[model samples]
Target: MARDGLAAHYQGEDIAERILSALRAAQGADARVTAEVLAPLDHFHGRGLAATTEMAARLDPQADDRILDIGSGIGGPARWLAERFGCHVTGLDLMPSFCRAAEALNAAVGLSARVRILQGSALDLPFPAASFDHAYSQNVLMNIADKARFFTEAFRVLKPGGLFAVSCVGAGPGGEPFYPVPWASTPAESFLATPEETRRLVLDAGFDLVRFEDRTEAMLPARRRMLEEVERDGLPALGWHVFMGAERSLELVANTVRSDLAGRLTTLELLARRPG
Candidate 1:
C-alpha cells in the first residue's frame, strides 16, 4: 500500500473528542484525565499499556533524557513516559488524525509542555542525526516495507550509546498471518520479517543487540483469553474499539489471535544500543 493509503487506513474523525467523551462516560464527567485513566483507550497496539510498560522498563529512560516515540499512536506511551519519568517525549506518526489527537490529549492531561507530537513516516524520520537520547517503537514495523531503512533511521537519530527498544509482530514458521489484523487490513500493507531476519536488520543497522526474545510461546495464553473475552462479551466500553469501530476492531482482534494460535505470527521484543 502507498503511504497515503496506509495513513487512510488508521485515520479516524474527531478522535480526541471521542476518546475524552468515552473516558467521561466511564469515570464520571469531572474525573481527572491522567495517563493511567486513558491507558485502556489510547495505546493503539497489541497488549496496550502493558506492552508500553515493558518497553519502558527495557529502555530505562532517565528523568533528563529526550526520548523519541516512533509511530506514536495518540501519544499514550509518550504522555505516560513523560509523566512517570519527568522526561521530554517527542511522538512521531504518519497519520495526521493521530498526531492531532495526541496533541489534544497532551494538552488535556497538562503534558503539552512535556510531550510533543509530529506527523511523519518511520522509514524517514523528520529529525536530524543524533537528535534524541533514546527511542522506541511498538508494533510499527509491520506496515513498513523497508525494514532496513526503518532501523537505519532509528539508529541515525539516537545519540551514541543511546538505547532503541522495539516490540513487533514477526512472521512465524506457519506462513502469513490472518488478514484484517490490527496493523493491516490485507497482505499488501503487512510486511512481516522472521525473527532471524529482524535480528540481522537491527545488527546491520549498527545496533549492538542487548536482548532479543521471541515471546510468542509465553504470550499465547493471555492472547487466547483476550480473544475469548472479546468473543463472549464483545469489546469493553473503554478500549481501542472506541476509535477503530466495534465490528472492525472485533474482526481484527479475532484474526490476530487466530493467526497466533496457528503459529503464523510471533511477538518479538528487542533492546539494542548504539556503540559509542
Candidate 2:
C-alpha cells in the first residue's frame, strides 16, 4: 500500500516498516491485550470488543442516519460503526494523512459506499447546520482547549432531536486538567471537565442532556492490561502499533498510562439530544 500523504507527513518514510515494528511489539506485549483478536496496534482500535460494542449500542445507528465522527483518527471507530450499523459516516479530522488513510481503509474494506473522510477541525466543520442525524467523538475532546466551542459545533451540525454521543478522557478527582493527549503536548490549553461541567457545556450549547456517566472503571483496566502485556510480551498486542515503533512514542504512551493510573485522568460517556 502506498503511504497515505497525511500518514507519510506525520509518520515519515517507511510507514509500513514503522507500523510493522510496532505491531510485532504489541503482539508480544500482553496475552490479553494482544491476543490476535483484541490488539490496539492493528490501527487505533483501542480497548477492543467491549468499547466497540458499547459504542455501537450507544449510537443505535440506522440506515436513515447520516452520522459525523469528529477527530476521527484514520477512521477506525467510524469504519467499525459503518460496517456494524449500516449507516453513512463522514469522518472529520484535521490531519490529511489520517483522512487519506481512512479513505483507503474504507475502500479496501468495501465500505466506501457508507463512509467518507474529510479533513477539518471540530470547531469549524464544513457541513451546514442540522446536517447530520447524529454525531460522535471518541477520546477526542482532551486535545481541544475549547469545550464551549466544541459542544456548540456539535450542536450546530446535528438535526433537531438528533443525538450527540461522546466518549472521552475527562478530569480526574477534583476536576484536575488532563493534558498532553496524542494531539497535544500540554494540558495548559487542553480543556477537560467533570461530569457536571460537561453537562453544563452541552446544555449551554442548546442540547438536552440525555445521559452521562463515568465509564472510567471499565476502561481503566485497559491500562493495567496494557502494561501487563508489555511486561509479559515486551509490547502491546493490538491497535496501538504507532506507539511501539519509536522509543519516544513508547515513552509518551507510558507517561499517558501513568497519568491515567494516578487518577489525573479519567474517561466517560455522554449523550445529549438536539431538541425538536
Candidate 3:
C-alpha cells in the first residue's frame, strides 16, 4: 500500500506521552487538557486552529449526526466537532501512532466515548455504505494518488444528503512544491491534483457540489503572521516539533511556505453533498 510506509514516517515512541509533555510545558501540568488547550497543536494544517474552526462552521454538523473524518491525523478536528456539536465522530488515519495518539487525546479531553479512532486508508474506508451523515478531510488529498477511489469511498460512506467538506493544497500552474512539505518528503510520495481536477473527481464520484472556494487569500494572512513570528521569535518551546523532531520539521515548514508563495501550490475549501 502507498500509505503503509507513512506509519513509520509519522511514528515516534510514546506519542501520547510526548504530546502530554508539551501540553504540560505550555499550559502548566495542572491545567486541564481540554480541546481549547490542544487546539493549536492538534490542527496539523496550513492555518492551524483557525482553519479547523472555519471548516467546522461550513460542515454545520447536527447533534445526532454521525461524522466521518478521513485521514483524521491526530483526531483534532474530529474531537472538536464531537465536543462542539454533540456529534458522534469516527476518525480514520493511515498511521497507527496517529490513531493511538488520537485516542489518548480523546480520552484526555473526555471524548473517548464520542470519538472512535481507526487505523486505515481513505481509498478504502472500512465503514459500511450510507454509514455517516457527514464526512470531512483536511490537507489529506495530496498524498492520495487514486483520487477517484478516495472520493468514491467518501461518497459511498455517506448517507443520502450527507455532506463532505474538505480543505487541501492543490497542484498549481507555475511549478512544483518543494519536497518534505507537510504531506510528503519527496515528489513521488505526493499526488497533488489541480483544483479543477479535484472538483471533477468529486462530481464523478456522484456528489453534487454545494461550494468550492479558493481559500489561499484568506489563509495567507494567517500564514504570513506565522512566518513573521518564526523570524522574530524562532520556534516555541512546546509544539508538534516535539514529535516531528525540531531539525526536520523546520525545513519542511519553510519549504511549505516557500512553495505556497511560489505559486506551486494553492489552498482550497470545498463542500459537496450526496444527492438523495
lDDT for each candidate structure: 0.91, 0.68, 0.85
- Candidate 1: tens digits of C-alpha lDDT, residues 44-128: 8888998888889888889979999999988999999999899999999988898999999999999998899998888888899
Q: How would you encode candidate 3's per-residue C-alpha lDDT over 125-150 as one tens digit per residue?
A: 99889999999999999888899999
Best by lDDT: 1
lDDT of 2 by residue, 158-219 (tens): 99988988877777774443333443445443566776777788899999888888866666
Stretches of model 1 off by over 4 angstroms after superposition: none
Stronger candidate by lDDT (2 vs 3): 3
Residue 272 C-alpha lDDT in model 1 = 91
Worst 10 residues of 1 by lDDT: 1-10
Residue pair clashes in candidate 3: none
* TM-score, cand. 1 vs. native: 0.98
Top TM-score model: 1
Collision count of model 1: 0
Candidates in order, TM-scores: namely: 0.98, 0.79, 0.95
lDDT of 2: 0.68
TM-score-superior candidate, 2 or 3: 3
